[model samples]
Target: MTGLLTDVPVDIDRDAARRAAAEELSDPKYRDARPNFLQQIGQWLGEQLEKLLDGLSSAVPGGIFGLLLVLVLLIVLVVVIRLRTGKIARAAKAERAVFGATRKSADDYRRAAAEAVSAGRYDDAVRDRFRAVVRALEERALLDVRSGRTADEAAAEAGVLLPDVATELRQGARLFDDVHYGGRDGTEAAYRALTELDERCRRARPVAMAGS
Candidate 1:
């Protein structure tokens, strides 16, 4: 009886086992069992991008206003600087014009004195001619050569470069002083001295002009 049982067949359905295994694998719960790391990372990146966009939108208006304010301030500063520079430039030009006019007047008077001496106008030479030369220099602000200044004082202030001519200038001034204040008669000698002084003034004019 034990030997006969060992030769008996067993009933097993292989197709049914395979069909059940396929059905279990095809279930929605089984198919979606594992978490997808790539999908999760994609979702996180999308959320981060939305937050960045929100922050930029919130800041844009204020940033634009600040940039506009800075631009306006810079423009105003440039305009103010330009205006101030123009005012200063105009003031400088006016000063130069005044100085040039004064210099021209001084040169003209010097020339007139020279002409008077050359023409042998002695009486006119001592008074109008020599006086014109001194007045012109004073008017141009070259020196403080005034009527009140003594001949010696004027000559001393005139300096070493003008020493040779300084004596002649002093003599002319002395003659003018004698005629005007000292009640002395104008003579040919006084006239000659005036002519010499006029020559000295002519020579000194260019030097003074150059210095100015």
Candidate 2:
């Protein structure tokens, strides 16, 4: 009975039918229903993660725990790579931006810097400390909180507000750029100097502008 249906002849224009189907699919509703680029990327990563887990499931001894350990290690490795490699800036005329995706309060930055110092990661400490200084200036209303503001820009602007600490602000900006963009190592001495600069900026009140 099924073979009889195959034997039936129908005048079907395959090209016209294909074109009709394509026209229907080109509708805005169909296009809107499709996954976006970011969504597609997320789905791809999820599928790859599942595949990796399946391969590890056979060789891993502790069942779920072993698989979870592998997942955790992979996450850590990726994070370490991003943190270490993301700091180096390509050759550009403008200095790199000071703040990153994660923004913190001034005190929070101080706490993070102290932790970095305890871990002997002076580079991290210096970066955090310099951020604290800039954030503190913003909090004090000496500088406005502008997105994508570079270190030199912050220093130059803040220097205008606090005349006494003007020289230190420029120096601090250069130090931050050196360690963060120049791919140079940060030292405890540098961190201390940044801390001193922060203190000076805090102590020195913003001077009144001319004709104000």
Query: Who wins the TM-score comparison?
Result: 2
lDDT, candidate 1, residue 182?
Answer: 60
Residue 18 of model 1: what lDDT? Answer: 92
lDDT scores in order: 0.59, 0.87
| lDDT, candidate 1, 28-130, per-residue tens | 9986985599988999999998786666656656665655676678999988887667877556434322122233354565465456667775444555545
Please list the residue runs of candidate 2 whose C-alpha ends up more than 4 Å from where it truly belongs after superposition: 1-95, 209-212
Error of 1 at 65 (Å): 99
Per-candidate TM equals: 0.34, 0.54
For candidate 1, the lDDT comes to 0.59
Error of 2 at 140 (Å): 0.9
Backbone clashes, each candidate: 0, 0
Q: Write the residue-wise lDDT of candidate 2 on 77-176 in tens digits.
A: 9888766656532223234778866679999999999999999999999999999999998898888888778899999998887878889999999999
What residue pairs are clashing in model 1?
none
